[model samples]
Target chain A: MTFKKFWVMAYRDLLRNRRRTVITFVAIALGLTLVIFMNGLITGMLDGMLRDTIRLDTGHIQIRAESYEVVKTSLLWRDLIDNADELAARAAAMPEVAAVSPILWASGVLGTASESTSVRVSGIDPASALFDPIREGLRAGEFLSGNGRGQILIGQRLADELGVGVGDRINLAVGNPDGVPQEGQFTIVGLINTGFPGIDNANVFLSLAQAQSITGSGNRASTVRIMLHDINDTDKVVAALQTPGLTVMGWRQLNEFIMTTMETGTAVYSILYAIIFLVVAVIIANTLLMAVFERTREIGILAALGMKGRQIMTMFLFEATILGLIGSLFGIILGAIVVYYFSINGIYFGDLGDVAGSLAFGTSLYTTLVPANLFLMAFWMLVVIVTVSLYPAWYAARLEPIEALHAL
Target chain B: MAAIELEHATKIYTIGEVETRALDGVSLTIEEGEFTALVGPSGSGKTTMLQLMGCLDKPNSGTVKINGQDVTRLNANQRADLRREKIGFIFQFFALVPVLSAYENVELPLLLNGVGAKERKERATALLEAVGLADRMDHRPDQMSGGEQQRVAIARALAPRPLLVLADEPTANLDTANGEQAMDIMARLNKETGTAFIFATHDQRVVAYAQRIVKMRDGRLVDGNANGSAK
Candidate 1:
């Protein structure tokens, strides 16, 4: 039979059983929705993490001391980026490279006249490019004095825990210029909240020179930090710059659990895809099988009228494809609505503190949109519907005209 | 030339432990342009003989031929082609596809044979008009009366312009008036186009329209008369 006639017969068959066709679509829609929702949830989690991580700590990507990879301890002669000043200039000159800052980061102890706390002090350039979330977190006073500072910019959580406000003097204990433990005093200049629970409670920022002085490293930074025009290509920059003794880490590698979870969620989404498609295939197959049985006599009459076996097969397959198309469309629409609603009005648990703490950075999560999921679900079911109709089409084509005509 | 030929044809059916022979040692030949009737009560093998002659079934023991081709050995595909090219069927109960209109039902045979749309429409329109159903061309089978539906069936049977038409109980479901009208149409078509027809029926009125009549009983042809006009 011609393509036109095949389609005509298929459409007629589907219209004859409109209720069954509608139900088949609903099944596809539900399966596709699950796929879209799961996809959104997985993507949303990682995107949220990367946003916060860049805001408070690593600005897209960061350069740390070569030794920082293996031993994250106080620096005592790591493979230094030789001539850090020249390399900083080279990085800053590249069009894709943005501002460059040399920071002296060290883990140390802070004490006041009354109390003390463990602190991670970052020696910063204090004036880098447009709206760094880490910099935005600073709430009071300036980061560094114009003539350099004998001052500290404290995080709000640390200030709250320590009962210190701006203008309070604090003594920072560090290794002195002779590599011996030494003490220095500075006035609190600013207080900030970065929103990263870990950093907000612990970070302190100082001028690069002051930080260098406290760490007893003369005119040398712990590491030179290069900010890029596009953070997405941090790995490419690392590949282009990884020397023999130094290692590079992307923001993703910094937190193993987040990357691993992203992978796990993706893998889980694929399994859900399999289950959803399998359901569509089975439903379509079962429906077509019954449909063929019901139309046996009709098929016989058509055949006796000289309709070819292949035409019969084509008709049934066309019906199956139409079923898939309608189902997938409805599914994508419904699924998108559900995904959108959930993404906008996220589920929250105020008591999720301990639970979130136990999770990777432990917080209750929300879903975001991932377009590929809906498309993927629709494509998956299209294949399923087409494939599932095969045996039934062939079965209808194989019916003996005489026997089927005499069938009651 | 004979339009249908059956030589020692037999059909065996497996019914549990019992084997029922639907056709036993049947042999007959129908000449072109002859309106032949195979008349018998139910289960007397008239329908079986009609099916074999129409190329719808293959015999186990012997040969069956239509329009000089030995169709018993043809595969299902070849058999369908044979039916398309040279044969048409008028069924007992007006087995019109419920979904299609009267015109589409008649258009079906031509469509399957790869006829183009304009020609198919023209042919179907002409045939339905010949069958006195031009005004009801768009009416579906379920929407039409039994006689109107049977007229549509006649138009379908003639659409392909086959030399032979095999009808199994063509008037069995119709009342006498509709049945007689349907027979008159077939007789007129047979006279006009010289299209041979082989009908299997218990209806004596159905037998009246045939030019030759064959009597069947107990899976065998017992007697026959040429120029069928007998009771």
Candidate 2:
């Protein structure tokens, strides 16, 4: 028979039992919507965490001494970049570079008269745009000067825990490059609240010059963090800043743990998506099988009218395709709307954010809509729907003409 | 050449441990343009005989030919092709595809035969008109009366202009008036198209319209020659 006639017959057959058809449509739509929404939420959470980490901790790229070990928080002059100013100047000249700052990292203890805690101290160029989040997060007091002495900024959460506020005199001790502890009394110049618990709970900041002088590392900083105008330009800037003695690292390499976690999470979600698709497929297959049972005599008539078994199979598949196409279309629209809404107005998790503090998860989670993922999901749903329908179609096709005609 | 020839055809049915011979050494010949009836009571295998003649089933032993081509060795697809090209069928149920309208039902066989669009439309329209269903062409099977649906079935059977039409019962569900009306339309169409028809029925009114009668008892022909026709 002509393909057009097959489609007409299939469509009309679906309309014959409108309620069942509609139910099947809803099943497929809901199944796809659930998956799409889940993917959107997960995408948003991962992307958000990565963005926050890049903003508050790592920049788009970091240039450090070839032998520098971040885990060790090393203060040896050999482990620090001595030409930080020159590297920062070269990177600042690049149009792709949004901001460049020389930062010296040290492991230190900050002690008030009543309380003490180990903290990661970041010595930063106070005027650099890379510190914009910290400046914007200044909850109290004033920001430090580029040439400030014996001054530091502590997180609001840390300040709350220590019962110390701005202008509170605190004793800070750090290991100098010579391996002896150097102690200095510093006044807390500002209180910052960046909303990222990883940063706000355990970090203190000071001017680059003060940190360098206290550490006895002459004119040396730990690393030059560079933020790009577009993160996609990280590789290009990294290539531009390729110096023989310094190692340039892009965001992907710097955030290897998060990338690995995302990959593992995707593998787990794939199993979930397959289960969802399989359930939808089973619903489709069951509906078509019931249709075959109900239309046995009609199938006999078609067979007697010279329609081959394969043609019969094709007709039922057409029915499935019609339902799938319309259902998936509706599903994609509904899913996009939901994802878009969540992307704008995020879902609040409150203290749940601190559970993943090390990953820089924020206080609220937003969804991200990836159009290609939506289409890919729809495509796979269609395939699964059609594939699962083969059994019912085959059953209908294999019905003996005389025997089917005998069926009531 | 004969339109159909069945020689020593035997079909057996095996239900669990029980075996029954549905058709036993039934040999018959039907010439082109002949209207014949295979009349028998229930369990006489009249329907099975018609099924074999229509290529809807294969004989266990013996050869059945359609348009002088041996179809016993043909595969399922080849048999379907042959049936599409050469045979048509009508059932007691007024077996119109319920989802399709009367016009599409009539056009179905033609579509299967891959008839061109213009000719398919013309022939389907003309056949529906011939069957007196031209005005009801847009109606689905449920919308049409039994007689009307049977007429649509008749139109569908002849759409491909097959060499023969094999009908099983055909009028068992119709009222007396509708039954006679359906038979009258079939008789007229049979004469107009010059297509041979073989109907299996116990209805006297249906049998009265046939030109030849082949009566069956159990699985064997009770009268007529080896050709199973009283000429």
Candidate 3:
């Protein structure tokens, strides 16, 4: 039979069972909507965290000491990018390279005449830093701008422990860039609380000139933080720049565990998504099968009336495909509805005390729309529905007309 | 030329573990432009004989020829092609697809033969008109009377221009008056168009329209050593 004719027959058959087809469509739509909406939430939360982390802590890429590259936790810092000023200028001139800031960073003790706390302080050129003016975190006195004399910025949590505020005399003690224990006193300039316990409690800010003065170093910083338009192109830019004693570390290397966790979570999400989709597939399959069985005599008549077995199969397949199409279309709409609802009024995870602590990122959770996920769910569900449709088609085609007619 | 010719035709059905003979070594030939009837009591293989000629069932052993094509030796695809190209069937229940309109019912066989939409429409409209259903072309089977549905079935049987039409008690569902009207229509079509008809029926009233009647008993030809004809 011609395609037009076959499709008409198939369409007619489908129209006869309007209610059942609608139910099947709704089933697939609901399943796909769940995955799309949930995936959107995770994507949103992850994007928020990435922006916070990237905007403040990791500047897309960090050019560090080779020693820090090998044993990242090692305190053996490097002040040894031989041509730091020249290389930073060269990289900054590139279009893709957004910013290059030299950061004198180390972990040490923050103290005063009153109290003390552990702190992670970075001494950076305030004007050159891309974002998160470490100065913002110093919720206290001024940033001791351009003063060759020492200055300090402390975290809010660290400030509470130290019993101090801006203009208070605080002694900053750190092992010098050369491993020599160094001590200096600076007026507290700021106190910061960024909602991240890691940053809010332990971070401090200072000027590179002041850090160098306190540590007795000249024209040297611990790391050159490189920000780029494309984070994944670290290798291309890193290879382009030849610097002595400098090691290039992209965000992937800097946050290896987090990225890996993202990958594993994605894989798990796919499996779960597939399971839910299969449930909908079963729903569709069961609906089509029951339909085939119920229309056995009708199918038999069609088959006996010079309708090819293949055409019969195509007829049912067309029916299933139509059901899937309607389902997927509704799924996109339903997914949009749920996405809009959750986007405006976020889902709450109330009082997640210990649970918050366990999360690798932070406590805030929100769904987001990921196109890959939507496409994946949509394509996979369609395939499942169509694949499930085949068995019913084959079974329907196999039904003997005489027996099927006799069935009634 | 003959319409349907069968040589040594036999049919066996498996009922559980037992094989029962529905038609045992029966051979019959129906001629073109003739109104022939196979009359027998229930379970006497009258319907089986009609189904065989209609290509709705395959015989256990036989050379069944329709317009001289050896249909018994053909495959499933070929059988469907043969049925589409040459054979037409009318069921006892009128067998109008309930979802379709009167016009679509007649258009089915043409559709099977892959007739173009315009031509199919024109031809089906003409056929429905011939069956006196022109005004009721859009009416569904349930909306039409029993006589109207049967007439639509008659129009469908002629849609493909098949040389032969096999009807299994085509009037069984109609009342006496409708049945008479249906028989007149079938007889008129047979005479005017010269399309052969093979009817299997137990109704004695149906036998009156037939020019030749063959009687069967116990699945065997009961000719009694003569060419039996109740003309």
- Best-performing candidate as measured by lDDT: 2
Q: Residue-wise lDDT of candidate 2 within B112-170, one digit each (tens)?
A: 88899899999999999998988999999999999999999999999899999988899
lDDT (Cα atoms) of all candidates against the true structure: 0.78, 0.90, 0.76
Model 3: what is its DockQ?
A: 0.42
Give each prediction's DockQ, rounded to 2 decimals: 0.56, 0.72, 0.42
Candidate that beats the other on lDDT, 1 or 3, i.e. the better one: 1
Which candidate would rank higher by DockQ, 1 or 3? 1
Cα RMSD for predicted model 2: 2.8
Candidate 3 per-residue lDDT, tens place, A1-408, comes to 466655666677777778887777778899889878877876776666665566677777777666664223223435344455666788898787988987666667888776777677677776775634454544555554664356677776678787787667788887765789888887776666555566767777778778766766566666677888887777787777645666777776777766777788777777888788789978887988988888887776676677777777887888888888878878977887787677667676654622443222334455666656677768777888899889999888877666665566
The digit string of per-residue lDDT tens for model 2 on A1-408 reads: 499999998999999999999999999999999889999998997898789888988899999888986456788778899889999999999999999999998999999888999999899989999989788778899888868798999998899999998988999999998789999999999998777876899999989999998988888999999998999999888998899988999999888888899999988999999999999999999999999999998888898888999999999999999999999998899889889999999888877765655434356789999999999999999999999999999999999887888888
Clashing pairs in 2: none
- Per-residue error for B68 in candidate 3, Å, reads 3.7
The full ranking of all candidates by TM-score, starting with the best, is 2, 3, 1
Model 1 misplaced stretches (Cα beyond 4 Å)? A63-78, A82-100, A104-211, A222-261, A349-354, A358-366, B224-231
- Per-residue alpha-carbon lDDT of candidate 1 for residues A107-168, written as tens digits (9 for 90 to 100): 77888778888887778776666226666667776566643568888887788788888998
Candidates, ranked, lDDT: 2, 1, 3
* C-alpha-based local distance difference test score of model 1: 0.78
Listed per model, the TM-scores of chain A against the true chain A are 0.74, 0.91, 0.81
Off by over 4 Å in 2: A69-72, A108-119, A135-148, A154-173, A178-197, A354-362
- Summing lDDT over every window of 10 consecutive residues in candidate 3 chain A, give the lowest-scoring window: A353-362
